[model samples]
Target: MKAVVVEAFGPADQLAVVERPDPEPRHGQVVIAVEAAGVGLVDILQRRGEFGFSEPGFIPGVEVAGRVQKVGEGVDRGLIGQRVFAQGSGGYAEQFVADAAGLVALPDPLSARNAVALGVNALVAHFSLRRAQVRPGEHVLVRGASGGIGLLAVKMALQLGATVTAVTRSTAADRLAELGIQNIVRRDRETEPAGPFDAVIDPVGGAAVPALLGRLAPNGRYVLNGGAAGFPPPEFGMALVQTFFNSLTFSTFSLNSVPAGEAGAAARAIFADAVRGALVPVVGPVFRLTEAAKAHLALEGGDAFGKIVLEP
Candidate 1:
């Protein structure tokens, strides 16, 4: 099997394509012949040794679309040859093993490419929106609205009947407008129609934090998910104190941190939404598996409008 292996964490350039042993299924596990994998900022961070989770020499990918090749003892053999998508690390290879509990059968109408897009970004958006408990007719603001997670957040918020205001530095206002989001704000001018919004979904935190808080209505929920703007992580104690003082709700979310039991249900709901066309998967670019370095570079370059995927 060929894989994108990080020999050491330094930069995207450190990622290399090389032959590696094909993974085999173990107890309660299944081996997938990976067809496609999603690439994102976290992969870049992992390559650069910035991500806090794992160490070096690991295959770095979190979401994949593939077909089951083998199922271990205690796992249903009927899953073999079934198309599926899963969320977890080590998906950047031609073959990888995964816990059977983490796999979801792919809908017949959903292509592998589209499934890759929905894998991480869409699921996170679904979880975040559910956590916010957004109500119809409520005004919701999404920071980094043009990025992978942000774009899905915009679509989901609109689908839930909330009025969405998207914040982006890109000039893709027309694209977002076509998706029924007319309230687009340029990054330079965030103060224009001041909001006492019901909820604010912020992926870019830094100065945007205080600005988002200012726009939130009393008792509004602020969900912090990512920091696309490259800001340092906030001081949680201080932020919590401020939230308490203002009588507001502040919560942080990471799909990587979600418990195993809850994650499956969330992924299922998100996939159903995508299959029903309530959520559209925006695929940016497709690279061959050997081009993993280029994929990571593209993700870190901040020019893509949607998820970048690697075809294995």
Candidate 2:
């Protein structure tokens, strides 16, 4: 098997492809012949040493889609050859070992690439909106709306019947419009969108926090799901104080807080929606598995419009 290993986190070049012996599944685990792996901002951050979750010699990817090649004890033999997607360690490889219980079977209509693109991203968007308590007939703002999770958040918010205003660079406005998003706010613009929104789904936390919070309407909810740009500036706290009289609600969310059974059910529902074409998968740059460095560079460049995936 070929796998990408983080020899030492610094630059994208640190990711090196090397040959390794194939892995066998342990008890309650299965080996997947990885078809595709999803790449995100976290991968970039981890590679740059900004997120120190893993040490040297670690395989960096987390989400993958493929077919079950083999199963260990306590796993169903019938599962072999079933298409599935899962979130686990060492996904940046041609083959990955994952707990059989964590695998979510992919419907026939969803391709492995699309499944990898939508898996964790859909979970993030779905749970973030739930945390924000987004409802119909309200205006919602989704910052960093051009990235994978951000794009999914925009679509899910629109489906919830909220008037979604996507905040991204001007380059993405036309594409977002094609997705039925009419109210697009350009982050690069000199003028900002006046929101007073019912809720704000922000996946990019940075200096923009204070201004976006100011746009929230009285009693509006704000949920911070990811910090792609880094932590909120010191003024973030002051921004909340300034909006004190608005009686606003602010919270942070992670899939870790949700029970496994509940999240699995939600993921299945999301997959069904994708199968029916209610939720479309947006795949951006596709790179070969061995070109992991190039994929990381593309994501760090921030020019790609959707989920960047690596095909093995």
Candidate 3:
């Protein structure tokens, strides 16, 4: 087996692909022969020693889509050779162990590559939308709308019949337009979208928070998910004060903070949307497993247009 190891967790070079012995399944576990792995900015932040609790020398992928090669005790033998998406550690390799209970069975219409692209990203989008109780005809605002999770939020918002305005870079204008996003605000060239937005899905936290908060419609909700913007806005005090009179809701969410069943349902919904053609996971650049360093840099530099996948 081979794994992309975060050797010392400092720079791009610190992330290297190295040969390792294959892992065997333990009780209630399954070993997946990883077909493709999703590359996310959180992975980059982990490589940079800025995200999660992982230390150096850990393999750095959070989600993978592939075939089950072996099953452990109490696991069904029939699951062997099945195509599935499973949440697991060490996904940046050819093989990794996943608990059988957490696996999402992939449908025939969804390819392994697309499953990896959509897996965690879509799960987050689905959960976020559900949390916001988004209504049809609501005005929705999606921050970082060009990134992997952001793109999915856009798709889900559109599917919900919300009028969505995407906040992204001017470079992403054409791609956003191609996706049927008519209104866009570039982070560099323009001001944030002035909403009266009924729901604001902000995965990009930071100096933008207060501005986005101010634009929210009275009684509107802003759900903060990720902080890819690095630094957060120093307006928590004001955000608290304004919420009182505006009757607004400024909330935050994490899939990890939820119960196992709720999280699993979200993951299952991601694939179901793909199978029904309601959403298409946008896959950006593909990298060989060995090219994890380049993949990390591309994602961190905002060069990856959609979910980037690394194939082993």
Residue range 1-312, candidate 1, lDDT tens digits:
999889887878888888888777889999999999999878877787888556788899988898999999899999999999887788899987889988888888889999888778887887888889898999999987878899999998988999998987646666777777889997665554488789988777765576567667877898888876666345544554665656778788888788876877777777788888877888887899999988877777766777899998
Q: How close is candidate 2 to the true structure, as a TM-score?
A: 0.97
lDDT of each: 0.83, 0.89, 0.86
- Clashes per candidate (backbone, < 3 Å): 0, 0, 2
lDDT by residue for model 2 over 76-168, one digit each (tens)? 999999999988878899999999888898999999999977988889999999988899999999988999999999999999999998889
Error of 2 at 274 (Å): 0.8
lDDT of 2: 0.89
For residue 14, give model 2's deviation from the true position in Å. 0.6
Q: In model 3, what are the clashing residue pairs, if there are any?
A: 206-232, 206-233
**Which regions of candidate 1 deviate over 4 angstroms?**
52-54, 188-193, 231-246
Among all windows of 10 consecutive residues in model 1, the one with the lowest summed lDDT is 232-241
By descending lDDT, how would the candidates be arranged? 2, 3, 1
lDDT of 2 at 191: 66
**Best model per lDDT:** 2
Per-residue lDDT of model 3, residues 91-185, tens digit only: 99999799998888888889989998898888788788878889999999999999988889999989999999999998987899998899888
User: How well does candidate 1 score on lDDT at residue 269?
Assistant: 76
Q: How well does candidate 3 match the true structure in TM-score terms?
A: 0.96
